[model samples]
Each structure stands twice: as C-alpha cells, then as structure tokens.
Target: MQPTILAALAFLVFGVTVGSVKIVNQGNEALVERLGRYNRKLRPGLNLIVPLMENVVLEESLKERVLDTEPQEAITQDSLAVLVDAVIYWRILELERTFYAVEDIETALKNLVLTALRSQIGMMKLEETYASRGQINQALLQQLDGATATWGVKVTRVEVQQITPSRAMLESLEAQRAAENKRKADVSEAEGTVESIQRIAKALKEQPNSQTVLQYLLAQRYVEANLSLGQSANSKVIFMNPKDLTEGIADFIGGDEPNGGGDGEGPKPT
Candidate 1:
C-alpha cells in the first residue's frame, strides 16, 4: 500500500476506537442517552456505548460533595433576627434520575436549604438557637433528603456554620449571662458563710470557755476588714467608731472581763 493511504487508514481506526469507549473514573457515574432519549447508566470504570447513535448526557460524582451556603437572615419565634449560614454534604444516589428529575439541582438545593433554615429558625427562640445546633442540623438533613429524593440525591448532613445576632443583642446576652453568674456566686458564698457560722456556733456551744476564742476570731476579722478597705472599689476612708472597733480587740488582748476572768489560760471544757 502507498504510505499516505496507510497513514490515513491508521488515523481513522484510532479515532473510531477511541470514540467507541467511554472511561468513567472511580467515584463517578455517567448517563447515556440513546436516540435522544433516556437510556442506561454507566458506573465507575470502562463503559461501552454506540458513539454515533448515542452520547453521555450527564456525568456526576458519586462521592460526597460540600456546598458552603451564603449567609442568610432569618427571624426567630421570638421575632429576633439572626444571620445564619450552613454547609451541606450530599451525593448522587441515582445517576439516571439525577439528570432527568431536576432541571437545576444545585439551585433547587440551595433554595431548599435556605427555606428549611428559615423555617427551622422561625420555630425556635434566639437563645435556643445557640444550644440547638444539632437539632437544626438534623432537621436540615431530613428536610433536604426528603425534598431531593425524587431528584436522586442524598443529603448526608448539614452544618450550621454561623448564627450571629446583632451586636447590641449579643452584648445584652453576655451581660445577662454575667449577671446570672454573679448572682449564683453570691448565693453560693452566702450559703457557705451561713454554713461556716453554724459550724462555729455549734463548736462554741460544745465548749465551756469558747468566749476567748470567739473574741480572738472577731478581732482577726476586724483587722482583715481594715486591711481590705483599701482594696474595695467603692470603699471610702470614713472614720469608724473607735469604741465599736476596739470592743473585741481589748477582750482579745489581756484586758479582764467584767467577771475578772483575765486569765484565759484555763483548760476549755470540750
């Protein structure tokens, strides 16, 4: 054969051989349309098709994909506005229906997600949204899956990325939290103080000569109060009554009681 004719034949054969087979990679699927109508689905690996009579209508990945949605604003049941955003995880469940069942799957999905988010948020209060993220995510997954089932899509999960309130509302929430914590701390400290006082009273009742110990404790507390006055934010250096301040200290030092019990070295009755 002539060299030019042989080369032409070889080129034609190679083109036809390459066009006859379609390579569908792993984690992917392809849909074949025959005579401009629905046909069979090709899964991962090599697939054969009639090159002249048919073509691949759609190709999609079977692997899970992520969609990061833009931030959306929604009102809570409390009529509070919050900015919400989410991430969606999805996969193509059926290749044939994925192409035929929906015109624009992604747009449909985006809208579906946004609507679901708004609806869910509207059913909850603003304060509940922060703690109920898992509930919101689960609700989104269920709603998305149900809506997209006909489209042959599976919504694996949804994650609420951010749910932020207005700066004023956020500051108010933080202040409320701090106030609640301080109230709880004050109550706890008061309860502890009461408990300690009760314990000390019981000990004093059990001892026959606990007056001297009580005087010493009172003097110590007086000294501590004097020392801490400078540390108090709202404290002023007001002159306190000298008589009231010296009452316990005189008893703690060697001053005799009215009953002349100046010798505080006696063994206490336990």
Candidate 2:
C-alpha cells in the first residue's frame, strides 16, 4: 500500500509539471486568460502559468503578413468600369488590442482596403488610374495605416497590382485611336495636294506656252500612274487615254498668264 501511494504522488507531480509549462517559438506571441478574464501575455520561449485556471486563448506570429485581395469591379470618375486588385503588407503591433478590439481583423482590413480603393479610383479618370499606380499605393498606405491604428495593426505597404478594362471598353478605345489617326492622315494628304497644285500653277504661269507645259505634266503623271499599277503584285492593269487626262489641265491653265491674259484682249468697257 505504501509503494502504491508513492507511485500515485509521482504521477500527479509529473502531470502538473507538464501542464504548467508552455513553449512559444520565436517571432510569436500568446495571450493568457485567467478564469475567462484578461490576464497577461506570453512572449517567445518557455513560459509558466497556473495549469487549469490560465488558458492560452490566442497564439499568432508577429511577423509581417501578406494579404492579396481578389479583383474588384470599380467605376472611374469618367464612369468607366475597371477591375482592380491589390496586395497588402501588414503586421500586429499590440497583441492585446488586436485580439480584443476587432472580432475579425483580416476581414475588417480587407473591407477597409476595398472601400478606400474604390473611393480613390472613383475620383480619377480611367486614363489617370493607369498612369498613377504609385500615387494610389501611397494613398492607400496612409489611409489604411491610420484607420487600423486603433486595432493594433500597422500597414507597412500597399501595392496596386493590376487595373484592367473590359473587352468592350478596350475595343472602343482602339476605334477612337484609329479614327484620330485617319483624321490626321486625311489632313496631311489634303495639305500636300494643295501645295502641289499651287507649285504646278506657278510653274505654268512662268512658261511662254502654259498649255504645252500643262500637257507635258499630264503625260508625265499618266506614265507614273501606269508604272505604279505595273509594279503592284495584285493589280489588274487597265490602260487609259493620256489625252483624256490633258483636258482638265488645259482648262486650269487657260485663264491668264503672269503678264496678261493669254487671249491678248484688254478689259472691255461696260
């Protein structure tokens, strides 16, 4: 009977020693609640507590954590829709407040980030959103850091990952850009045609026989046109009369010379 009592006492002592010891790893913290109330915090390494009364309610890493949010649809100031997503880097500063202040820290932080992102995007045009990534990130960091301060969270960095437009919006932008380019091309071609006509008229007025000079230019243009058609791989060449091209030039040059009217007639008295 004596030997059996000694063995029972040894087992009890061993059980108490094991239950009182708590081992916490590096870069981690644990909160202890005594009898279902606030008690104390346990840092990294071995800690001692009352075996049954004190409970380790929370134990989490204090290191930086990353939160990557899903892509969210938002509207710009110009009323264009865009898909925006981001990455956040943050960590807990005070474990006590972090555990008690917010019921769900991660969910609350994510919602705050989404709200702030939409607000910032809503204030800028779609074009500005594409060009202002750094500005957006900095603004988010400032807003989130301040907002989460009470929750014992420190937002270290924020990054806007991607801002993408819908397929329809992309197509519309392409069409707009193409129309602008075509307009510029048309203006340039019209200007070139005007300059060429002015130069041709000036040269013809200086010639003694403007009709002959105009005829020669018409013939040259006809030859060049035929040559271009012959060089084209897919062209079906068709011959045109050079004389038909000369009539338009003839009318253009017939009016007057630099010195006087080509008809050698003075102005008639009314």
Candidate 3:
C-alpha cells in the first residue's frame, strides 16, 4: 500500500513538471510574470516556468503585421472634405511592453493613425494633399513610430491607399483646368501666326525680285478669280500678258517712249 501511494505522488509530480514547461514558436516571444509582477521574457523555443508560481500572460508575434485601415473623411485647409484611406505595417519589438504596456495595441494604433492623418490633412491645401502623398505617408509613419514606441510597437511603413474629393469639387476642378488649357492654346496660336507673318516679311525684304514673283502670283490669282466669277454669269474674263498690260498702262499715262521690240536698237512707235 505504501509503494502504490508513493507511485501516485511521483506521477502527479511528473505531470506538473510537464505542464510547467512551455515552448515558444520561432519569430515569437513569451512574457512571463511571477506573482502578478513583471518578470523575464522568454525567447523562441523551449522555456521552463515554475508551476502555479509563474504565469505566461501573452505570446507576442515578432513577425511583421499589416493593418489596413478603413476610409476616413478629412477636411483640407481649403475646407474641402476628402476621403482618405491608408495601410500600416508594424511589428512588436518588446514582448513585455507589447502585452502589458497597452491593453489593445491594434485599436490604439488605428486611432493614432487616424488622428495623425487628420492633423496632416488640416495643415495642407487640397492640391497639396494630392501632390504630397509621399510626404504625408512619411510623416504618419514617423508619428506612429514615436507614439507606439512606448508600447513596444515599431511602425515599419505607412501608405496612402486612396484620396478622393467630392463629385462636385472634381467637376469644378476639371472645368477650371479645361478653361486654362484653352486660354494657353489660343495664346500659342496667336504667337504662331505672328511668327509666320514676320518670317514672310523678312523673306520678302531679302529678295527685291519677289515683286516679279508677286506679279506672277497675282496673274494666277486673276485666272482663279475669273474662273470663280464666270460661275456668276454676269462676269467677264480678260486675258492679257502682264508685260503688255504694263506697257499699255504706261502708254495711257503718257510716260516713257516705247522700246524697240526684242532688239534694244532705238525708240519705236507705240
């Protein structure tokens, strides 16, 4: 009877010993407390604790965690309401502080992130908000890192997911941009016209014989004009060489004596 009683006590002790031993997974940490007071943190793998004396409160994951936040409404400096969404990457650095320093790290992190976003958006204009997303993200990460440091949480990065303005505001902005582009296009067209006119004038000034070319061009214009006028039925077409027309006009005006035809010998009768 004594031997059986001793065997039972030994079996109970063995069971208690096995229960006291805890194994932590890789990329994780275990926080142990003695008599409800702060105690040592256990690294990954096998760890032994005193049964009924030391209690393991929580196991913290050291691997990075991704937290995607819901969309939040933020008012810009221009008083325009914009919807902003973001995501944060974080991980716990200190096991003890992660479990004991904060009751709920995720909730606290989300609130902190939202407040930081609001503060950032409030200081920036609508255009700046869109243009400075990178700056905003960096600022948010920095702020979150600072705030969560005490809670043993490290913020790796913060990303802006979406930023949207109201439909009316977007339409107004589009109209404004369109009007500005139209004004620029008109100014460019007018400048191009002026440049073309200046180039033509410069070319004409450089070549004095351009007047003869102009006369040929005028003859072509007359032919085209006559063809167009014939469609009116009340118009008449006249055909004459440009040299003969010039000479006839000179004679009618009693200007110079007529030159000999094709020989350059002496003056001849008209």
Candidate 4:
C-alpha cells in the first residue's frame, strides 16, 4: 500500500510538469489569460503557465502577411465607372492592441483600404486615375498607416493592382482615341498641302510662262483628287468644273496689289 501511494504521487507530479510546459514555435506569439483576465504574452520557445488557471487565448504569427482585396466598382469625377483592386502588406507590431482594438484586423483593413481607394478615385478623372496609380498607392499607404497605428498594425507597402474600365467605357474611349488620331492626321495633311502649294507658287513666280505652269499643275492635282475619290468606297464624289478650280487657284496664288497701286486697285492682269 505504501509503495502504491508513492507511485501515484510520482505520476501526479509528472502530469503537472507535462501540463505546465508550453512550446511556442518561432515567429509566433501567444497571449496568456489568467483566470479569464489578461496576464501576459509568450514569445517563441518554451514557456510555463498554471495549467488550469491560465489559458492561451490567442496564438498568431508575427511575420508579415499579404491581403488582396477584390475589385471594387468606383466612380471617377467624370462619372465613369471603373473596377479597382489592391494588395496590402502588413504585420503586427503590438499583438495585444491588434487583438483588442479591432474585432477583425483583416476585415477592418480591407474596408479601410477600399474606402480610401474610392475616395481618391472619386476626385480624379478617368484619364487621371490610370495615369496616377503611383500617387494613389502612396496616398493609400499614408492613410492606412495613420489609421491602423492604434490597432498596432504596421502597413509596410501598398500596391494598386488593376484599374479597369467597363466594357462600354472602353469602347467609347477607343472610339474617341481613333477620332483624335484622325483629326491629327488630317491637320498634318492640310499643313503639308499648304506648304507644297506655297513652294510651287514661289518656284513658279521665278519662271517664265508661270501662269501656264500653275494652271497645268492645278489641273493635275484636281484629276488626282478625283481619281482618289473614285477609288474610295466611302467617298462622296463632288464633280467641279476644272476651269473654275484653276482660276480660283491662280487668283489665290498670285493675288497681290500691283506695285504703286492704291488699296482700292486690284492686281493687274498678267
């Protein structure tokens, strides 16, 4: 009977020793609550706690984590709708505040990020939103860092992933871009034509039989223009008399008051 009681006592002591030992893995932390109240935190490695009275209420990794938010619909200042998404890199600086200050850190962070993203986008035009992604990311980081400081979470980096316009908006933008390109091309072509005419007029003024040469060149240009219109499927062909066109071109190219003439007097017949 005496030997059995000693064995039972030894077994009880072994059980208590095993129960008191707590091994915390690296990069992890645990919060201990004594008798259902806050007590202390356990860092990596072995720790001890009163088995029945103390409890590990929380255990979390201290390493940095990534949170990716889904694309959210946002309206630009121009009333255009776009889908925006982002990625947030963060880590806990004070586990206690992180646990107590916010009900769910990740959820709160996501909502905060999205709210800031929308607000920033709301103040910008559609074109500006696409061009100012860096500005947006910086603004978001600042805003988040300030806001989450109380929660004991450090926002390390923020990245704006995608900003996409809706299908209808994309099509409209493409059409606008094409129209702008066409307008630029037309202006360039018009300038080239004017320059060519100026050069030809200057050259003709220096040559004998200038009037005949100008008339021939004007007729040739008119014929080529007509041929181009005839070849185009969408051209609205306008048939103009060649004589009138030539006369107009000659008057424009050579129209200048005769030397020593009054303003009321026109050019003398060449």
Candidate 5:
C-alpha cells in the first residue's frame, strides 16, 4: 500500500474505534436508542455501541438525591391556610423509563408532592397538621412512591420541614396554649390546697394540743399574708403595744387567763 493511503486508512479506523466506546461514570446510567427506537441501557463503566447507529439519549445519576420543594400555601379542613415546605429523597431506578416516560422528572416529582401534600392537609385540621408531621411524611412517601413507580423513580423518604400558620392563627394557637397551661396550673394549685386542708384537719383531730397549734398557725398565716406589704422600698411599719398583742392573743384563743388572766371576750384594739 502507498504510505499516504495507509495513513488515511489508519486515521479512519481510529475514529471508528473511538466512536464505538462509551464510558459511564460510577453511580450513573445512560439510555441508548437505535434509529429512534429504544435499544438498551448503558450502565456504569465502559460500554460498546454500534458507531453511527446507536445514540445515548440520556444520562442520569443512580445515587440518591434530595429535592427541596418550595413553600406552598395549603388550606386545612378547618379553612385555615398553612404554608408548607418539604424535602423529597429519591433516585432514578430505570434510566430508560426515566428518560422516556417522564418529560421532566424534577418538576413532575415536585408537583406530585405538592398536590399530595395539599390533599393530605386539606383532610386534616390545622392542629392535626402541626401534630402529625410523621404521619404526613409517611403519607407523602407512600403517595410519591406509588405515583413515580411508572416513571422509573424510587422515592425513598419524605420530610415535612415546616408548617406555618398565618399570623392571626398563630396568635390564636399561642393564646389557646397559654390558657390551657393556666387552667392546669390552677387545677394543680387547687388540688394542693385541698390536700393541705385535709392533712391539717387530720392533724387537728389526732393531736391533743390542736387548739393551741391552730391558733398559732392562724397567727403565722396572718403575718405571712401581710409580709408582702413590707417588701416595698418605702414600706412603713407601725408598732403595736405588747400589752395589746397579749390581750388579743388571749382573746383569739378564747381564754381569760392569769391562770386565765386575759379575758376571752374579743380582740383588743391596737
């Protein structure tokens, strides 16, 4: 063969060889089509195809990916508008179906999620929506997985990141929570007071010096009741005569003592 002819043939052979090989990276896939018809899938690593006959129509990742959905306003069963944002975990399962069956996978997956979310939220009240995040996530996962099955996508997980009520609704919820807490506190305080009264009554019935103890307890409570009055920076204290206090104490205990010197008639004026 002539040297120039040999060089031209060698170059053509090199071009043909180069065009026949396809290398797909790890965690990736490619779809091949032959003359406008589905041929086969090109998996990860080196693949061979007929030069000028087969074409790689699409390349897609096989690894799991996250899809963050934009916040969407959805109405609850109670007619409250809630803004919801979510994340979807998914990946392509079949490259051929992914490329041919779904026109736009991301857009489709997101829209499907939004629709399913709205539908689920619509069936529940605002409180239920807030409280049922796990249920909502599971519901979304199930719906998305089922719907995307035909599109060659596998939805592994779904998460509801945020569910925000409107300003007025939020304020109402806060008020409701506060009122509930207050009611609980009041009930607890009332229970404690009742328990204290019962214990005191039992002690009085069982003890021989109950009357004297009761009188002392009453006096102590009276002092404590007025203790807050003396906490102010400008608080004033009035001195009462000890003689009058002694008389009052006797009167309060219904005693005229000397041996019962103080008359038990009534309290003496301070």
Candidate 6:
C-alpha cells in the first residue's frame, strides 16, 4: 500500500509539470490568458503557466515577414488600364495586440495594402505610376502603416514589383514616340540644309574677287549635270576660261582700253 501511494504521487507531479509548461521561440512572443481574459505576454524562452487555470492562447512572430500580394487591375487617371503587383515587409511590434486584437492579421493586412494601392493608383496617371515608383512605394507604406498600427503590425517597407499597361496603350505610346522622333529628324535635316546654304552665300559675298572659287563650283555643277544627262547626244556644251572672261567683263563694264596698243596705230596718230 505504501509503494502504490508513492507511485501515484509521482504520476500526478509529472502530469502537472507537462500541463503547465510553455516555450516561446526566438523572435517570437507567446500570449497567456487566465480564466478566459486578457493576461500577460511571455517573452522569448521558456515560461510557466498554471496547470488548469492559465492557457497559452497565441504565438506571434517578431521577425520581419514578407507578404507578396496578387496582381490587381487598376485604372489610371488618364483612363488607362494597368496591372500592378507589389510586396509588403512587416513585423509584429506589439505581441498582445497582434495576438488578441486582430482575428486574422495577415488577411487584414493584405486587404489594407490592396485598398491603399488602388487609391494611390487611381490618383495618378499611367506615366506617373511608371516614373514615380518610389513615390508609390512610400505612399503604400504610409497607408499600410496607418491601418496596421492598431493591430500592432509595423510596416517597414512596401515595394511595387511591376506595373504593366494594356497592349493598346503601349502601342499608342510607341507610335507617338516614333512620330516625335521622325519630326525631330526632319527638322534637324532642314536646319542643316539651311545652314549649308547660308554658309556658302556668306563666303561668296565676303570674297567678291573669288572668280576661281566660282569657276570651280560651276565646273562641279557642269560635271554633275553631264553625268545626269546619261549619254544623251543632244546635250549642249559651253566652255570658257574663267580668268579671261572675268577680265573682259571688267574692262567692258569700266570702259577701259586694253593695256597694249594694237599695230602701233595709237603712237603714229598722236
């Protein structure tokens, strides 16, 4: 009878020990409840509980967690349809609220993020969304942080993974860019031609005595014209020495006689 009582007492002690124990993992916190009411939170490492009156309700991870959201359809201010995807980085800051206040923290967070993204996207144009990804990310983080504060979740960062426009919009943008580029090229070409002509005219005006330059240019034009005639037999040919022609024209216009007397007639008559 004495051995039986000793063995029963040992079994009771083991059962109490097993039922009153709790272990919290690293970077985690365990919420303890007593008599179905709010109670203290257990920090990382081993903790004790009352055998039957106290209960371990929930465990909250303190480590940063990544939540990748599904791609959502959004419309821009410019009436463009876009598909946007993003990710959120968060962690539980207050273990008590995280475990007790929110029924489903992860789902609530995801919904909050989606709502914020749609609001932000709706306010921006398609081009703005693409160009201002940083702004979008910041806006998302701020909005999510505000919404999750009550749930004890801290949003560390939010990042936009991709923003894609519809096929029709992309094609329209490409066409617009191509047209702009072509217009620029044409304007540049026209400007270059105008500059070349102006430079040539200025050179000609500055050097009025440049008959040699004029003759060279004329000869080049003649050669090009002849080549373009393509073996035509009826092409007319005109030829003259530029220096002689220029001197003759100057003497005629100035009413000046030739330098040398012809046949010595001038000396005899005088």
Clashes of each: 0, 0, 0, 0, 5, 0
RMSD, candidate 6, Å? 11.0
* lDDT: worst 10-residue window of model 3: 253-262
Q: How accurate is candidate 1 locally (lDDT)?
A: 0.83
Candidates 1 and 2: which is better by TM-score? 2
Per-residue lDDT over 161-269 for candidate 5, one digit per residue giving the tens place of the 0 to 100 score: 9999867778888999999999999999999999998787677646666556666776676677568767877988775554455445544344343322334356669
Error of 4 at 108 (Å): 1.2
Q: Rank the candidates by lDDT, best first.
A: 4, 2, 5, 1, 3, 6
The C-alpha lDDT values of all candidates are: 0.83, 0.89, 0.82, 0.89, 0.84, 0.80
Candidate maximizing lDDT: 4
C-alpha positional error of residue 69 in candidate 1 after TM-score superposition, expressed in Å = 0.8
TM-score of each: 0.59, 0.69, 0.62, 0.64, 0.62, 0.62
Considering only N, C-alpha and C atoms within 3 Å, which residue pairs clash in candidate 4?
A: none
Give the runs in model 4 whose Cα sits over 4 Å from its true position. 171-270
**For model 1, the run of ten residues with the poorest summed lDDT:** 252-261
Candidate number achieving the greatest TM-score relative to the actual structure: 2
Model 2 / residue 248 / CA error / Å: 3.6
Local accuracy of candidate 2 as per-residue lDDT tens digits, 51-136: 89998999999999999998998899999888998999999999999999999999898899989999999999998999999999
Global local distance difference test of model 6? 0.80
Per-residue lDDT tens digits for candidate 3, residues 1-270, read: 999999999999998999789999999888888999978898888999998899998887899999988888889999988888889999888878888788888888888999999899999998899899999999999899889989988999999888898676788889999999999999999999999766654554356454454456557766787779789867776776776654453333222434212233464789
List RMSD in Å for every model shown: 10.5, 5.2, 11.3, 7.2, 8.5, 11.0
Q: Residue 68's C-alpha lDDT in candidate 3? A: 89
What C-alpha lDDT, on a 0 to 100 scale, does residue 64 get in candidate 3? 96
- Greater-TM-score candidate between 1 and 3: 3
In candidate 5, stretches whose alpha carbon ends up further than 4 angstroms from where it belongs are 167-270
Candidates 2 and 6 compared: the better one by lDDT is 2
lDDT of 6 by residue, 116-229 (tens): 888899999887888999999998888887888889889999999999986777898899999999999999999999998777656754564544555577667667866777
